[model samples]
Target: MLITGRTLRSLPVLAVAALLSVQLLAPYATAQETGRTVSVGTGEPGYAVNLFGPGEVTVNAGATVTFENPWFEPHTVTFYGDTEPLAPSDPTAPVPTNPGEVVEYDGTSFLNSGFLFEDPFQVTFPDEGEFPFVCIIHPGMAGTITVVAADEDVPSQAELDAEAEAIFAQALDGLKTTAGALAAQPISEQANADGTSTWSTAVVGGLFGPSDVQQFFPASIDVGVGDTVVWESTVPTPHTVTFPAGPPPFPEDMMDPLAEETFLAASGPNDAFGGSGFVHSGVIGLDWPAGQSYEVTFTAPGTYQYICLLHADQAMVGVVNVSADDDDAEAQATPTAPATPAPGPAPTGNAGLDGSGGGNMVGMLAVGALVLLTGIAAVAARRRTAR
Candidate 1:
């Protein structure tokens, strides 16, 4: 039934939820002069903070600074100095020298908070000097700590908290603007020559800055039975439109970096789905040249749920409601075109951080809620380049 001038009505678009809420760390008043704190990473749908909050901070000698991350994304606080820096043989493993331990600094020791570190990492500086650090996993995610003499004055803990709050607040503001644009995205559909229809949706679309979105634009859509839905990754980070019984529990199926062949290349059976077995799109998007989009045909009339394994913790989920075709149904609206974003050329070869290494590292480490699933031991080929 190819109705050229007829429009297919879609479900009412929901108002963007609190997808960008920022969790500000409460002021910590510990024994030794109440140290300052820095936010490692924060995220919500369509927005994320890649760089450290209050990227630069100043504290007096003997004062402690705690780095904390309460968001879904994982991060490492690695400090480099006179000591030659070394990345873990497995990028997913914590640095062997200081695996999950409080670090004391004299200004020259190489320090790392390891990958997927959940607990707040506290570091005390007994000597005063400017110390620079980087999240080895994420290229360009760097920050510095300026230490003054014990008697010199520095920004108080309250002041630093205010600064971090301002940074997060600004990110939230930007997220709202981007969400408005994304929520306005319409469901794209086209009637096939065989009378079946194809619907298109955006995966992690609408990037505003350095931040990578963790959302599915037009998260939900309506289609008739025998229709097909295609999910396209419009951003750089990898994502999967996977249909399992429901969102998988944390760490159970953490993306295995070694199995890039299976998870990155294979698009399991394309036969029409009546909602039983797993239908995985694998990892789609940047650097994955095999294909950057996936489609699945729905044969039954029912509601089906899907999620992006890479960002399930951030609630990167969507739904497709399929209804039986009715010859008497009338067209209620016109079809909308898919968004055409001109992303830059994909990286090739041993492209480090910005390329495959860093980008893929972030995707692999982005397992699920709170922290990386505890006690999942999998060795991944290490790539030390920045993201």
Candidate 2:
């Protein structure tokens, strides 16, 4: 069904009793053992941090918190109430992360993957409450842990099913929103051999990016250094523009973990200068220089990659490679145009080559949460139905 909901109007007393039994014996049935592990990935639903792996684990009393390090970046599992301060803590602090705090489990509460990290916190929950935690590496990645009371009275499975349906509806809505934002973005803005991509790659039939500037309109483009490359959004959903190098002000080459991700407003067309631009609203209109067409142009050579920031799953990325020689060669080969202007000439639709190399790296986020989300819905439904 497009939507799911249990038809049960009432949960039987026996079912409720059964659920209570399961909840009660959970703490004692199992002897002291390994801790429960969780993860919180960036850009997840309702996450404050924009990293990855905000995984969740349910626990009874005496459950431990084991945070794993799957990503190369360093991260820590922090509590909401604790404040361990120190100098030069993360400047991106404020819901992004808590820096310089005392390590909860001898820094094992944090995982840096030093040669090989096997640190796990065996701290038992021993009570019922919600504990939210996140990855210190990516900052915003966050998730929650719920400890259920041994004697707590919970509703039947059928009652929980109804509540699951409601929350699932909200999740579907979030997907729609994310898709819309994707549709509004320029899947890519490639840097051309001559510093401008004359066509939209999709308009020309290339999948990842355009091929060769030979078939482009004007056969090339022109612009000052500070000009912008405007990409038109034809499809309205399920696409993402990603940059493997992260947003610019790009470092000479930020390879090691020790280097901070660099960002800068650098140079572009006509010998003018410009910084990197973000997908403020996803859509690109004719909002460049007064005389410059939304088309790309350049006076130099460089390589650039861009992706639909929202639809990373759809694998939308574009690469732009510009060279001064490209313009020189085109200038020597092309015929001069008459100074008269009428309707715009037909665009060749040849979105020359592209470089959106950061393939849908973030696409798996939505799929990874499906199972957990379903369980959460079942649990929450029990609450709503009982009300």
Candidate 3:
């Protein structure tokens, strides 16, 4: 082949164009090679409770299905029959009974990906079959995967992504509506003459079932650095008030020294801690006659964000804006209706509480009445002390 200088110069241009084309097509090729990556939960603001997007998916036999958890909470992808699914009323009840049950996938063998948080779990299907899975922690959360013959066509990555987007959008709208309804309820408050404030946690709504979802009565609040803020759980379900810990002025020290050390030891490294100090109120359960309350006096001035570790991903988050000016704190503090007895009966058979019998409405009512009376008496005593 007789090569001319002009032709040689054109060769470089052609090669460059080919390289650009390959670069652009790389993503699509990789998507196909990787099979399908299904997002297990939504990361959208205020709507993180979704179980899965594209609740059902189709993939070629022998293709790998990657389940990704993008939200803050932990989830699992366990095939039906792999293990007993916990009742929706008592999701956490299974953990004790089914601890460390890891199943290895062997085509016919049961498969279960324990709880996953901010990570992805992958399982390859070597045969054609329909597999249904659920998050044992949330039995109502279920999905299905259809594995067709190798030659059958499956939904592409683009299609799955679009479907996920739509699902998340709809979930976000539902969350906003639920949150707004809860927000409309008058927050119960009892302001002290000493300039402290308290906010109660309420069962706002449920994700999988009744009372599964909860949030801070006043999701946001303002206070002075020296002022104390207290959070009391008003429901039987357990919850934690957790602030990401890291950087200077850790808020853990603001709590009891013993509690702070205990939390640090259990929480391990604060790799996820951005700048705020880590502070956690260990599992507040119904058995705590004191109403499972936690109080922290802000030592530094800034906007601190916190969450109920159990329901954080479900948008159960709150914020506290601390200022140096007492006047500013008092002005910004949310006003609330006077404290009153919470209407609903407390959950039954909670391990901490009496645990006499399941669904003890009368027992629950008695407990509620006791709590209401205690709150009233405490307020009166505080007023007397102040006088």
Candidate 3 lDDT, 39-140, residue by residue in tens: 776533233455677678899888887777655445667775445555433434323223343223454434566566434567777778888887765546
Q: Where does candidate 1 stray beyond 4 Å?
A: 1-34, 44-47, 82-97, 106-110, 246-261, 269-271, 289-291, 326-387
TM-score of 2: 0.34
- 1 against 2, candidate with superior TM-score: 1
What is the descending TM-score order? Answer: 1, 3, 2
Order the candidates by lDDT, highest first: 1, 3, 2
Poorest stretch of ten by lDDT in candidate 2: 205-214
**How accurate locally is residue 254 in candidate 1, as Cα lDDT from 0 to 100?**
28
lDDT value for model 3: 0.50
Q: Candidate 3 — number of clashing residue pairs?
A: 2
* Highest-lDDT candidate: 1
* For model 1, the run of ten residues with the poorest summed lDDT: 2-11
What TM-score would each prediction reach against the true structure? 0.70, 0.34, 0.53
